[model samples]
Target: MKKTISFITENFNKSSPDLVGGFQGFQRAINMEKEDIIQEIVLSGLKGRGGAKYPTGKKLMQSAEHHDKEKYIICNADEGEPGTFKDRELLLHDPYGVFEGMLIAAFAINASHGILYLREEYKYMIDDLKNALNHMRSLNLLGDRILKTELSFDISIFLGAGAYICGEETSLIESMEGKPGRPRIKPPYTLEKGLFSKPTLVNNVATFSTISAIIRNGYEEFIKYGTVESPGTKLISLCGNVNKPGAYEVPFGMTIREIIYDIGEGIRNGNSFKFAQIGGVSGPLVLPKHIDTPFSYEDLNEIGVPMGSGAIIVVDSDNDILDYLDAVQAFFKHESCGKCTPCREGNRQLLNILSRLREGKYSQEDTINIEKIAKTMKYASFCGLGQSAPAALLSAIEHCPQEIFKRRD
Candidate 1:
């Protein structure tokens, strides 16, 4: 049984009164030269937790290279992934930790303003977040010249309208600009021309919180936790068929078996584990044979799966794989922004195929079409939404062909 790691959740038990005010990381960040701060983060090997797993230090260095006087930091709190709620827990329990991270980033990149782009589903948390901001302001942890340093930064919360596509950085930026939530074409990536066409640094809630931990504990201590290729801990939103379904923070090298059987207390009802979906709905399926695979970016990548959104949804043997595919396909179909042809049409066709398979009317042609469209979306889709929408379907077709397709007479 793997023990729960406590880097990020170390202060989960502390109340807001105890958690708020006096951010040592932010204090230390303000005093250091911006270049040194970026170097420290680069050395820490902290990657973005918003599914892409991009190097946080590299992104920060790029943003720093751009000498735009009006740089901005956007903390992506829009936890739109179906099974991922780790960000919500962070915002709910340790909001100040998030704020400190944003401040540290802002200072590192000379960003004057920060925006917390929160999802509408989490609207109930708006008031609490605002109050936390006010408290930070009162303590001089936020607003102009924070902690009496020359570095000045402020943060505001903008409510998202529950659109899944807005989880993409460009789409979120468009919505913030009062436009509809649709992804933009790349080459002016967020680091280049983001949020009002100014240089912006967009990072997820978990990424920011982890940044705070790295700063608080120093990069040396942070690197001691996880694997060489994937250092530090990840907060996983473990759900579905598991006895213990909740947010768990664990080191990167722990295997799926450890996470499921040990941390999650194994599959519910003693029914036996069928397969687990690591990451969110778009994440690829991990079969029983691969359950022992270490839960790290490099290892999962070796198996052609991504460490997306830190969501692990376990499935039991009793449930039909087609039914699960139906639900997942339906979500992607509904969430397709229709901005691009591949995603908008591909998801629709994918859902249609699932429906036919469920009714026992699907053909080998339908199966072929699923692969064709899934590959099309993976290669040609406009954004991450369209690109990753076919992950679960592809995994199913590859790993459980007997279960997903109908037998020919």
Candidate 2:
């Protein structure tokens, strides 16, 4: 069967019939019953692709249910994960899809304002999004009286300084408000108190982009593509030693073997695959034994790893796993924001321990101490960054235990 969605397939490349018709379809769908749209989305089982994997329809429903006078829709385009760049690709080639998705979300939640919180490093995409916004405005798809309806919605592009933590919804809102990007405590979730302390629906760019297609095709149709739980498709950025390293939109339950071999064309230069990082830096490292493990949030979680940010970094036997762990430790240390002591000091200490180990100065006793510190940090850190920072290291220790052991005389 021919695939409907493929890796790197630019859905919004040219002014084709489908592209023009998609806007018209969205305009018509926006006028349809909001409850029906919600039902369709719920049936679709679309989850947030921005690492959290929260139900998109459920999030919109919460915002809709808690509709105060001022509700907002936020498109999280701050693709800050180190190895991930799929959102950047979507924004670059499919800006219209994202805009339509935002509009659909705004219509669902009765929101007036929409903000695309994009990263500053995505300069080309930012420019392209701005131009796309202008095009939508020219066609009267945005602004007051959208598509001749009473619904008045407008989208603004809010640029973010290159901060990884800001990719979190709360931090993104804070950054957009001209404050330092620090994650706020949950409980009073974004749907309750978000940007400007109003009810906001913040979703990733890819998650929102899928909304239009879901609304147009119905939820059941969308669900036909992937597993019952992880419905629809996922775009994963395959990098590091892959022959055809790029973005690939595959079904959710596809194995790592399928991704690396079928889609990625196997390892480069015939190098044997030793291990792989299923998610971004904050995700766990999977050894060759877990190659058959399906790529899904639940599957990864069951195995004590997370498919966070959908970035798979393959490592060969020749690569030093300890060095990779050290790099991960350093990344968390540098990006910790120093908001809380556990993360602030914990990451620093962890990096120091890893550095000492690298210099062949740490014994097994030091390794035990390092593990203890990581456990403390996991429980005490303020946000996901600090909490999951030790995952890479821990997974490395589990799979490559001998790598950390010193051969003494």
Per-residue lDDT of 112 in model 1: 86
Per-residue lDDT of candidate 1, residues 1-409 (tens digit): 6699999877664634335434778767877888988999999999999989899999999999888888899999888898899999999988888888898998888888899999999999999899989988887777777767776888999999999999989999999999999988898788989999999999999999899888877899888989999999999999999999999999999999999999999888998888888778887788888888999999999988888898999999999998998898889989999999999999999888888888878787997898999999999998888888888889888888988887534
RMSD of each: 1.6, 2.1
Q: Pick the candidate with the highest TM-score.
A: 1
What is each predicted model's overall lDDT from 0 to 1?
Answer: 0.89, 0.80
Mark the regions of model 2 whose C-alpha exceeds 4 Å error after superposition.
1-4, 7-10, 15-19, 407-409
Cα-based TM-score, every candidate = 0.97, 0.95
In model 1, the clashing pairs are: none
Total clashing pairs for each candidate: 0, 0
